[model samples]
Target: MLIFKNLGEMASLEYLYKYDMYFAIFQLTFIALLGYIILSWLFRMWKQYKQLKNDKASAELALLKSKIDPHFFFNTLNNLYGLAIKKSDEAPQVILKLSEIMRYTIYEGENETVLLKDEINYLEQYIEVHKIRYKKTVNITFTKVIEEENISVAPLLFIMLLENAFKHGVESLTNNAYINLELIVKKKTLIFSVENNFEVKENAQTGIGIENLKRRLQLIYPKKHELLIHKDTSVYKTQLTIQLK
Candidate 1:
């Protein structure tokens, strides 16, 4: 206002030349203020864009994780149904194990992470449930060496690999089938591997489980984890290493 008043008081156009310094100062100040406002607005928009992208990613990951529960329960219930039809003595124990697994899936699966110990227990229960279904036709072995008990891992991460192992390796085998799994944790790294004998058929199509697991791993672990799968003749093997830190 003071600058404007000074300019207004100068009646002659020639007098305006003497106020060139004030005019230059005012013009620079206005441009600086305008630039600041525009930059601030752009920054705010960029921040919101990143947040929305993250939210969408999180939502998609949650949906994928949710699919695992129903798929697992469906298979488990089918096993129970088979046992019930046969009136097998292991039916009751299978039911109990299923109940425990369901409890973990319903409660702990909702969490982003669970204690490594709890996850291992869940896997043991899952393997036990499968063993009851397979009986003497299949041999399953699980070994683990844990250097730390207090570690945390994403829920349901390893289960898909185990599921794939049983589905492709032991489910259709009539006799002499075996699955061996090992888990080793050293410092901040965890290594899980599963190997099993499978009878490969002509034109066997892959299932959605592996793709789903890959997508989940990409979203959760990104570059922090490694998954390797190999098949040779009748043997299929997979190994996954995750960086816990």
Candidate 2:
């Protein structure tokens, strides 16, 4: 106030002295603000780093999962062709169902996520067609413990697992073969459990289906999903649990 009241060189000296004491304070404040900005920028960079990692993993997993559809469709079509060549009475209905499965597998299966209930319906339809194709030899038992209206899941994820269970389990059975599915939704998590009976073969293999399912889970849910598979002398059991996002 005294510096502002006076004029000339005397006032200039007084004003400079007064604010000189605050010079260090202003420098410190500027430094603090700059540090804060740098820290915020680093935090944003770290978050982007994490997101990029997740995206890369997802892209790789999507590529792996994309491989599954071709193999699956090829095998299914081969199976259907065999049925056609046999001149079976159920061939017409089998073709219609195949068309539906193809549509779903090609179109809906490409999505990142889908209603869990819809995927389940697609699986049931596919299994039914397969049951018709393999009617004489395979016995399938499917049980649903979760209401389909309440849940959603990553699209086409569980189908490959189910397909593998049936392929290996059904192919090895001489008679009385059964595949059982139980879906349980508890709180915010969903548990899908499948068990199938199969004869012990010398050349049993865990094919591309299992690998694809693993990659899909890692990409889609990462630490939020759990997959467990148990193979005993005669029964193979698989359980996948995912925390709904």
Best by TM-score: 1
Which pairs clash in the backbone of model 2?
A: none
The whole-model lDDT of each prediction reads 0.86, 0.80
TM-score of each: 0.85, 0.81
Q: Compose the digit string of candidate 1's lDDT tens values, residues 125-224.
A: 9988877766566788889899887999999888888888887788757789998999999989999999999888777666777788888889888899
Instruction: Give the per-residue lDDT digits (tens) of candidate 2, residues 1-245.
Output: 65655666777788898798699789999999999999999999999999999789877866876677454466667777887898877778878888887788778877777777788889888888877766466666677766446566778877877887777888778788888888787677898888998887887676788878887787778799999999988999999999987
Looking at candidate 1, the ten consecutive residues that score lowest on lDDT are 9-18
- For candidate 2, which ten residues in a row score worst on lDDT? 65-74
What is the clash tally of candidate 2?
Answer: 0
Q: Which residue pairs in model 1 clash with each other?
A: none
